[model samples]
Target: MPPSPRNLDELASALLANGPVKTLPAAPKRIRVRLGGRYVADTTRAVYVWEHAYYPGYYLPLDAFAEGVLSYPGSGGGNGNGDRESGYALATLSAGGVSTDRVIVFTRRGESGSEREDGNVLAGLVRVEFAAVEAWFEEDARIDVHPKDPFKRVDVVFSARPVRVSISGTEVARSEACFHLYETGLPVRFYLPVTAVRADLLRDSAAVTACPYKGEASYYDVVVGGVDGLGEIRLRDVVWYYKNPKIECAAIAGCLCFYNEKVDIELDGKMLERPKALFS
Candidate 1:
């Protein structure tokens, strides 16, 4: 896998190599963000920034942020062209009379020729680290990943094609009632109902990961008999499911999907070649 973009120039190059950036209107939901027991931002108006080859990020208006929370630490220097520049800043969020350094915010100052339909400027916008925050809420329930992009599409379609998953020659799941999830810029993900999977072979795992587009996911370890002189093999956190997916991806709710790179998957009796992606 290629290393992630480290600086403004690399990020710009990556973006140019991929496609154009999109700025879209998001759903009007009350978003309350906190960090280290401090309320960082509370807003009902946030936009989704869909950058090429990257997950959508939330950008709140400057007025939405609490006062005295954002302070400029220093400049992040230029992008080598001398035209584009960036700066680093520290945010101190506070609540209940307690304060903490929430995150290091990065601000960009450049002209990318990208314009929003609403005529709002994208430059010099303050973007917070989604993971650095202690908690994030959409109205009432806490959600994982960043805010789902309203413009991004997620389709979960029922497939009649047979899908099978195996680990070391041991069948783990097979289903005709499989749901195929198609998300933008991602490989096709096959999801099987719990009834079609070998529940006995799956053990709850502590690992949890989030996708800004898919929502929060829980993992399961697959313990199966190994082949080629390897005895019992445990594939840690190989299977995952979203119990409560974001509304846009609700079609895949409660369905299980395995990491294709870590397991053998067959569709319609033909083995699938693992796709090269950010995760691979």
Candidate 2:
């Protein structure tokens, strides 16, 4: 027995897959993809599906076709344009439930353009339905080098800005450094080693956060830098330190954290504005 016509679900699936074949987008429903004053597929009736290389595409039915539009140039006759001979012919079809209005038929090679362009012809070639086209979703996240630095570069400038460090009511350090970034849209965290900071001034805090760009970070309290007292200098979870970042951002493995507004940042002795968030 001959094979049965593809079911609704199977037909829909194939149409979506064929939408973005090698490069072009699946035939759109509402838009006119007229190569010769003929309708191919209606985007409105089709459903978009997923695939590799390209993306999800619009799928249309086969029965609602109007007639010949595509012309297969090559399989046999020596057409002047190599590309022309290899392509197929197609036409638009009217929607009729299972046989949607978006349907179109593609002709096989070795067929005449005049013969194949009309859907009424081509009793031998296979029918591949059109599907609704869908766009691919991209991954976007913030990365901080302080979390991970697999690159192993020293002084990696993920981002640069001014930062203020205060303890006990008085500001202790203010400097401008490139806040290394691990991912993309996170804060430009500065990488300061333990030695650069005064150990006696820091107090343990239980603040922590995870970054897709970086790794994980621990928090600390500014207990003794300024002369006034502990109450005068309080940065709640403002300071962060990356424990073991990737190799590229190795310089700021165990530094401290401070908000730019609280400190005076200077680059080459000139004060600089607070750096914006890595996401911005």
Candidate 3:
């Protein structure tokens, strides 16, 4: 995704088994990972390694590793995998009784384990799986999902265009001063103010999700179809809002957004096709 950027779903397609791979210069952001309440690496010297995922993982320098190195850079050390002299600086990381079980190694591109890669740019670099760590941080803010892709962008713009949403022919929400959140690789979200939504129909949902670009989000379950022949139905977690969003997306705070795929939506009186993506 260096020359031409593509979304994660494209890489997940079975037809595209072997695809184009690219790398960029080391990013300037100070990325840090925490394991068992201890900081793993807190440095700006990190490279974005985009492999199977659309968003890249941070590959920090060898020095970024604290005293948590169990085995590395030596004679046929155990890489949590049963192999010897793989040419990769395989390591086991442990802190506060938490450890990586399998496939936790600082790998080089061209080696016994990763011979398919013909280069050594990824050699001597420590790439940690996010799930193996307790928390990941960009500066001080906790990042969820995965590392934010530099190529991807999120923008919130105030718009006056009329927006409307209907569920099973029942008008749910209509707004004139809604905000449009355009996020790369996702469908555009129409974030309407709370006053524009039907608060009586909305019930608090237990679902919560986090984003690296946007902050933690709380959801709402909208109840509909309580009149005529239709039975009363509760659509679960179909709407969400970020009470406190990341600084870059502060404009979307306290705004309600419906799942464009779950409900019928119209913008400026024109019907909009339901978007197809992971959210859909």
Q: Which candidate is the best by TM-score?
A: 3
Better candidate by TM-score, 1 or 2: 1
In model 3, which runs have C-alpha deviations exceeding 4 angstroms?
1-21, 72-84, 87-90, 96-98, 108-117, 139-142, 227-230
Stretches of candidate 2 off by over 4 Å are 1-155, 158-169, 174-188, 224-231, 276-280
Error of 1 at 130 (Å): 2.6
Q: Residue 263 in model 2: shift from native, Å?
A: 3.2
List of clashing residue pairs for candidate 1: 76-87
Q: Candidate 1 on 124-241: residue-level lDDT in tens?
A: 3445656656778888877676666565577878899999999888899999868899987678999888888899889999998777667789999999985653788898988999
Cα TM-score per model? 0.65, 0.36, 0.77
Q: lDDT tens digits, residues 1-280, model 2?
A: 1122345334434433353233222233332222223343223332333322222333233322234432223323221111223333332222222222232233334553423342222222223333321111111222231112222223456444544454433555554544544334333445544654566656788987754334577877665434567434555655578888545555567766555544444444565555665322
- Residue-wise lDDT of candidate 3 within 121-149, one digit each (tens)? 55445657676678888889888777788
Cα deviation of 256 in candidate 3 (Å)?
0.5
Q: Count the backbone clashes (under 3 Å) in each candidate.
A: 1, 59, 0
Candidate-wise lDDT, in order: 0.67, 0.40, 0.72
